[model samples]
Target: MTLHRFAFPTAIHFGAGARKGVADHLRQAGCRRPLIVTDRALAALPVLAEFRSHLDGLEVAVFDGVFGNPTASQVMAGAQAFKQHRADSLIGFGGGAALDVAKVVGVMAVHEGHVLEYVWDHPQVRPIVHPLPHFVALPTTAGTGSEVGRSSVVSEDDTHVKRIVFSPQLLARAVFADPELTLGLPPAVTAATGMDALTHNVESYLSPAYHPLCDGIALEGTRIAARSLRTAVAEPGDLAARGDMLMASMMGAIAFQKDLGAVHACAHALGAVCDLHHGLANALMIDTVLAWNFEAVPHKFDELAHVCGLAGGGQAFVPWLRQLKADIGISGGLAQRGVRREQLPRLVELALADICHQTNPRPCTAADFERFFEAAL
Candidate 1:
């Protein structure tokens, strides 16, 4: 086994009411005026009211323009808001989309060029400019672990392509993982996002990487999702289950730095073109992708099956996964979720372009991607 260096920079605070520490963390980071980036749905939540009251005497502006699958224009607009308010820091205050946009805003605030110019497209790219003010992430959902991740997903409005902006410096300086904030997630969102977390764990575990640490983390993360996701979805206010899912979500992100595979590649393409829920798209493709790749690395799936506590070795995983999905009320394939067969050609092309495809256990061509889509559909 080759030696690998692991370094995660974000300082994380986890537990119930962990969000209460945000103000103190901001002060410790020397952020007087911070821009809170969130979406309309989260902006109206009463949980944010406490943060607002905490900042009553301080300078804090809220930018609620962030939308699902954030766009480059939204990041530019957020940058403008950051500058206009003379904000000294950023607080990502919602789910993946909000956190991703906040991270991009932090990048663009210090960089001069158009936001898309900085996006690393698989090959080489210029180094990021000076890091923006300290970023504090407070997740209101238990998925997308964007708070601790270095890459931000943004959509190009014209092409409608979801592009990833990669930079180690984009990770939040501090993160608040308060499961209490996730108690209000709708059942559908809960099931979909939790499945997204499960995909991250399973795919990372299957990725052809040399990081045993990530493999172990992914295994445990998968276990947590399997055990807790359904409970969290069924009983939204169950703090213990919610906390487990939140930790699993963060673990999935950390583990996937080793790599993600066909599931994410398919989801990214479907999300860009069809505007389907990213997590749901991933959930639909995961089993099919797993079936395709299981033969390539049967031992890994065997291990995953063991961790998920199944009796059969590798083959048990898919049935367990399907059962989990059904238990959580995640029923339906990509076609049922609005993905069309006619769009397969374009979707296949876009899925090929996704960087995640490179890490798949089984290397896939455009034709392979088409087959995967057809199977999922």
Candidate 2:
């Protein structure tokens, strides 16, 4: 075992009407002109208008270049927008992709080189010597919890390989998590994002890391998601259920500081090769990978089953996940969800290369990854 470090460092203004505080939060931080970094679809929605309505005393500009999976080019484009408007701060306003681009826009704006130079794996990665712009997040969805996350995941323009820009400084200065913002989500989006949250909790808890604090948070996060996801999807107007999902999403993001496991590795590979939505990718691969992983840590599965209120403990966990996915209209394997059988070699290679699987409770090999993809296919 190795020494571990634990830190939970985000100021959260949660619950209904939390979005109303963004203007004041910025003012207190001495920011006036702030760039609203968001996806084009979200930028056109009434949610963005309503959110903007609350910022009565500030000069606001919208940079709606973000779309699909976040990419290094999007970050550069957003940084250009930030400079053109001479924005003093940033407001990440949308789901994970938008928020991820927003998190790094300032990094690109102030840094000397290309955005890829900041990726953690870059051999000559530049240090974040200058202070990043004052940035805050307003999550409009109950997934990814990018609002409270400390890293920005941006994919390459050509290869589509996801590169992680990780640093404590990348964390949002504050997070405004208002469940009302998620009330407009369609049933499918709600289900996929909810599963993303659940996968974060489950995979983190299954990691072979030694963070008891994260383990406790992960279990409780799993419990919250288990009890609330169905309600959230079935009754989109149920604010309480929406709020529970939001809390669980943030808790999952926070808990994954302990690290994630093989599910994420598979999901990341799918995202790169198939361009699948990150949440949906996680949803598709979770059951298959976990079923295989069950043999490695049956006791952990027992703990998971107990938290989810399953009767058969470890024996019941994977089956419960499968049922849950079907209940929420996410019934499918990788093939059904658009992953081609021919992409197996690339997916397996990418999965094996992904850093997330290195911490899996069960050690995995190239053959295991090939088997995981084949089984799911």
Best by TM-score: 2
TM accuracy, model 2: 0.99
lDDT of 1 at 55: 67
Please give the clash total of every predicted structure, in order.
0, 0
Give residue 3's lDDT in candidate 2 (0 to 100): 71
Give residue 165's error in model 1 in angstroms.
1.3
Q: Which runs in model 1 stand beyond 4 Å of their true positions?
A: 1-3, 122-126
Model 2 off-target regions past 4 Å?
1-3
Which residue window of length 10 is worst by lDDT in model 2?
1-10
| RMSD from true fold, candidate 2 | 1.0
lDDT of 2 by residue, 43-71 (tens): 88899999999999999999999999999
- For residues 311-375, write the lDDT of model 1, one tens digit per residue: 97999999888888889888878878888889999999999988898999999998899889998
- Candidate 1 clashes between residue pairs 3 or more apart in a chain or in different chains: none
